[model samples]
Target: MLLRQLEYLVALARERHFARAAEACHVSQPALSEGLRKLEDELKVLLVRRGRAYEGLTPEGERIVRRAQRLLADRDALREEATALRTGLSGTLRIGSVPTASGAVSLLTDPFCAAHPLASVQLRTDLRAEEVLRRVRDFEIDAGITYTPDSTEGVRTHPLYEERYVLLTGASEEPAAHPNVTRPNATRPNATWAEAAELPLCLLEPGMQGRRTLDEVFTGLGLAPRPRVETDSVASLFAHVRTGRWASVVPYAWLHVFGVPPGMRALPLVGPVHGAPIVLVLADRRPGPVMARALLEVARRTDAATVLERLP
Candidate 1:
């Protein structure tokens, strides 16, 4: 069967609509339908569940779609290999990163681009830890930056750094001269988890690894924190904390990389000291992709101490 037919099949499975899939493949609906029909005839098995509207793929069709995805990924890998042999290593490197590690991703990407000037890099920062691993396994992303837990099997991980948590809040300004005035100590050097939980706080959503770690720590300490606001974006958390009325627990490196916004202050978390080991993950394929290998080289040479020191 033609590779084009396989492309049409995969697109149809993804879109789950005949017209949308045709649009995605840049072909007419009738042409796409004819292509799939021809493919089924060649294979001697019905691929699509035909109806007035678009019915789902048949059981065999589902199996073929999975195989087709792998075939397309292998084709792309072959093309990348050919290009590398002709010139130097050059192609788009897709990286998925968890929200807390998003700011620190530049530490790896910056040096990687400098070493391979012709290579392009795409960084997806809002992925959850599970999503990052899922994308890597599915060939959707070349690598990812996420927390290094104990369950990484069939995946290679490179430890980058340990992320320490901190409390972010607005900077306390001096109160004007008045007979009755009280100012809170917003610039405290450190705060306990219990203390931070008492404030109206904004935090990352529960699905995120960063938020999960914080939740576990709080739970272990016999504290239950009900956040005033929950969001998926770390930038949004910072925005809320900047209002002086809200606070959040975030990574120390986040404050260093993004800087304390004009009226914000970052305080170290006290009491139960905790940190998560951030790592770079790639599928454990024999002779992995050239771009992923190049990124691993950069990670190997990166000095975690130096990276932390360079942070603002």
Candidate 2:
């Protein structure tokens, strides 16, 4: 019914303990309890189920809580935008990046920091596309770098670049030993996908968008790569592949992030290599001055994947 009631309800939903939730809201237990009751009565619904202690929210309450949180977050962001307009660019800009886009963050960060030296840029990595959307809607993150825009209404997007998949392998000890590979062609140590797939493979978890993309390509080529190791973290996969015990499918941009470790080799995913579009996503509403400027600068300077021409 009231903003304070919605705030109390959110705190309770998060903490699930009356005393702790009350403390979080900077109110006494009785005050929080009373506020919730008033809200429930006004809504004419049993928002929270009853029990000896603080129980979970009712199904209806859960739905309301999610919408309420988004509304509250958006309202606060609007206020921040107004204040920031007057103060100039000097505040936090939170960004979430998926594993493939992790390498792309630096492309934006360096230029953004140079432009707004006083503003704070906070970067979070390993966010999935869906998680990025949830955080953006909740105002938890200002923007995200990820695969092509997935049509989340109320979110704006700018294409960062196109990402092409690449195959990486541990440095071959006996390049000559594998007849499948041409004798060290200097370019890639001259390895092909067929040769690369022969090694142990480390791949992203099945559920990840990156993995699915790679799987489609492999399946289309009739290449069945049985991963010896599977993980959700791209960093972990790269680390394993770096040891030469495993091979991996990674974005060409990531070759920069993981670097071509001493014996590591990266081969383009030939046989109809796929190029998926990547984009920078932000809430549709106006962002704070710092975030708005940074986003603009990133869009202006980053050709993102256009630079990948240099990769082998």
Best-fitting candidate, measured by TM-score? Answer: 1
Supply candidate 1's per-residue lDDT for 30.
Answer: 97
Candidate 2 lDDT tens digits, 1-312: 488999998888878899999999999999999999999999999999878997799999999898888777767666656666787566777899888778878888877777766678888888888888767765668888887755768677888878887677665655432344332244543345564455567889888778887777677777787776899887887788666556777888887676676776777766565788888887776543347546766777777666666654
Candidate 1 local Cα displacement, residue 254, angstroms: 1.3
Best by lDDT: 1
Reference-based lDDT, residue 230, model 2: 92
TM-score per candidate, in order?
Answer: 0.87, 0.81
lDDT of 1 by residue, 56-175 (tens): 999999999878877787788788888988998798999999999998888899999999888999999999999898778667789999998567775789999998888887777454
Each model's backbone clash number: 0, 0
The 0-to-1 C-alpha lDDT of every candidate, in the order given, reads 0.84, 0.75
Residue 291 shift from truth in candidate 2, angstroms: 2.4
TM-score of 1: 0.87
For model 1 the local lDDT of residue 169 reads 71
